[model samples]
Target: MRIAVPLPGTMWAFDVISIIQIFDDDSVMYGSSDRPVIDFIANASSKALDHGMSIATTALRDYHEKPDLIIIPGFANPHEIATDRRTRDAKARLFTADPADALAIRDWLVASHREGVEIAAMCTGMFALAWTGLLDGVECTTHLPFLDDLAAQFPKALVQKDRLLTHNAKQRIWTSAGGSICLDLCIALLAEHAGQSLATAEANMLMMHYPRSVATRRSDGAPSVLPRPSRQSDEIIALTRRVREHLSYDWTLTTLAQTSHSSTRSFQRRFSEVMGVPPSTWLLTERLNAAKELLELTDLPMQQIALRTGLRNADSLRKHFSAAFGVSPSRYRQDFLRTELRPTENV
Candidate 1:
């Protein structure tokens, strides 16, 4: 697989380097025996650093050999970096005065997509993907802080704030939250090309526990809780934790209310008010979360996973998974498993 990485001034160095290392390690551990050769190109118009001391890349020409995959790393601060005059001037010479580097990267992205090349962005790199119009009508994610901005910037894009990664099949765009998660995303791609064992080995070499499948959602509909700010808040949080701990068993709101020694109605209202969701909603979300983890990390079948997660059957599990995420439980597993197979393929 041919991979292109276009660096830009102010680019987060670690994002690009980590991806390169992940692919390299995969090749040594898995490809040395049977995988395809993974070709990489650090394509750029000129090598420079932005004021923020981030590395910048040169532009990729239209006639340049198209890569099988392209990765765009995040910048130190995408908002400020995008507005830098030198960065704008350099990109303009490559792309068209004051042309946004995001647009330049988008052109190559679109071209690569047309050729069936996979395109991925890490962290705030989703910002650039959004600018390209390629992510229009596609589900994608970025750093949590930018979720609202991303939605506002590209209304057509389904910005999933509560996800570590999101893939838009219709547009062939994949995005993941920035920072160390980029390593997880790259490992996922390697897994898709190779196999799960190889992906796990590579992750182990990096001292990382292979992430739960990339298909896992950040929100399983659980209430987002803040640390208890006072004694009353702490008591509520303690109750919430207890409920979460018992998710795999049959527990009811009345049961929880009784435990907390409050009237059921008052307890329900208090739980909703403190946790930002009702107790039942929170319990179901916790169960679904447990199910999701098992689905991604284990080879267990749907029936077993459902039973272990406290769901009655596969049908019940699917209802919750589909309602929480737009995809079925089985489909999520397949998507995640496919990524694991990448590094094992004849690279």
Candidate 2:
């Protein structure tokens, strides 16, 4: 059977690939293995992990054939987690590397799933799969630290917050929680094709338990390793979430501080601590991001797009978009349109 793995934001992606490779060889599985064929895919530009490693990846759009299974690995967002452990916005962070790139990957995943490919996500990679709408009304789980955020962001998903691993048998989707438990997910997937005995033996040889053990949850339902954020930090996170959801609102530092129930000074200090950006700067960045998505996905006029993103006018949108992307809005949209019309056309 053929398997596809998308090169994700985390170095754990490599770990997942390594496990698959170990089971892929003839010596290991011999007569019992499915003899899996693996492919590493990414968007046009290869993704660089936060840990300073990069891999050569086949562009998913250029890969014509669908594999029997697709595995999405956890995304690395250590900085965000470190700042506010309890409020790690999984969906927002999914767009951190590049919104267009993330959307392309999500679109490909949606199309591939519709074609009958079994999809699995390791740890917080469930955020990527959730963005594809495959997890709606289906049982799923992610890294414990991200459980609350994942549920808040994707409410339709039946998120088993305490489950180390869970599967939707009908849809052929699987999810495993954080840490080395992702290794267990790979073995579980193997059992679907290979016999249980072979899978059990492989787990034994690897010194991992065959079946998932009950994951202990704290009384407060928080990940023990990630201490809850301070009340001030939670307030700031809530304010930021509101800002993201309502980009069309006219937001100012004073108004933002009011929303979070803090003074201007305290609000600025805490917001910077949690988000690593001053309120105004973060607002501009988010507004421009909304504008970028609008440019790519809609046929609205520049003025309308600017208004929708709270940029006031086309000229303002052009200035900020050109400054940020090194191209005017129209040019960027033109390039996107051409790419859409000729998907296989290489840049």
Candidate 3:
């Protein structure tokens, strides 16, 4: 599993290198020391640093072999970084990346992806990935501060502001929310490329619990939070987006197949092929996911929440919610209720 990191401009965070090191170490431990070769390929042979960080790597033109995966690290936001003695000279390179470099890197990524190289972007690195136009119509997320900018700039990209991770299995692109969560994304990518056992070992070594969404936790403690897009035709992807936006709507296999302009049998086969679940199962999962969000973010009554999420009533919602999350709707809401939002008892 050869890994590549592309360097276009400054403000390169350490995510790319950290991920490489972990994978490289695991390969060595598993007696494949020379496997998973790491390469830092750039448009230029050497890019000058802005005083805060430095890296030495080869030029893309000089590297002949294509990598199995490409990981782009988040570029540091200037406002987020304090201007201390080390980084006082660092330039603000967030959205204002060098156009020529960005274009060169974007072109390389587009070409590489066509040849089946999986791409993963961390935090604001998503900005660069978004530049490739592959993220258009694909679900993604970024650092909280830049989520709006990412959506505004790439109007076609489906930005999930609340999602900690998003994967377009069809395109083989993975994106994550910003900050240390990047490490969690790295472990996920690691689990996919390497084995899950190694990924679990690495997470334990790092003393981090694998990042799992409450709605998809497995008993084994492995991560199951990779909310994936349909890995099939555009019709399927479009159908998925529609279902998510209208979770409250009463939907059936017939209705869903008609919406996608396919017959019921064909739609079921295609949807299940890409999503690993039938249309009905997918719809139920989406509804449950929406319910969890409401439980965390709103104080709406259980009946209203159920109605809004297409779960019929409070009893149905409670049954499904507990089955998925191992807790009742009321209990789930209690766990996420803010201190200020909680009702005060009489003194």
TM-score of every candidate relative to the true structure? 0.56, 0.55, 0.55
Off by over 4 Å in 2: 8-14, 25-27, 30-33, 78-96, 213-347
* Tens-digit per-residue lDDT, 1-347, candidate 2: 67888864554645555456545745566753245667778764566654577666687668776787898877776334323423223443444455566667777888888899989888767777887889999988888778887787778999986577776657888888877667767777765544333555666677552234222222222233533589876777677777877888888999898888779988877776655446676788668756866776689999998988889889999998887555799987886566446423121
Candidate 1 lDDT, 1-347, residue by residue in tens: 55677553346767867776787765455434423333333345444333434343434553366566777777566665334344323433332223554465556677778878878888877766666667878888887777777787668989888787776555567789876678878877765545445566677688653243344556532234443577655677787667656665667888888888889988887776565556776677567767766766798999888878778789999998887655798997897666556554332
| Cα shift from native, residue 323, model 2 (Å) | 58
CA-lDDT, candidates in order: 0.65, 0.69, 0.68
**Candidate 2 residue 310 C-alpha distance from true site, Å:** 68
User: Model 3 reaches what TM-score against the true structure?
Assistant: 0.55
The reply for model 3, stretches above 4 Å from the true place, is: 26-30, 33-35, 48-51, 77-98, 213-347
List of clashing residue pairs for candidate 3: none
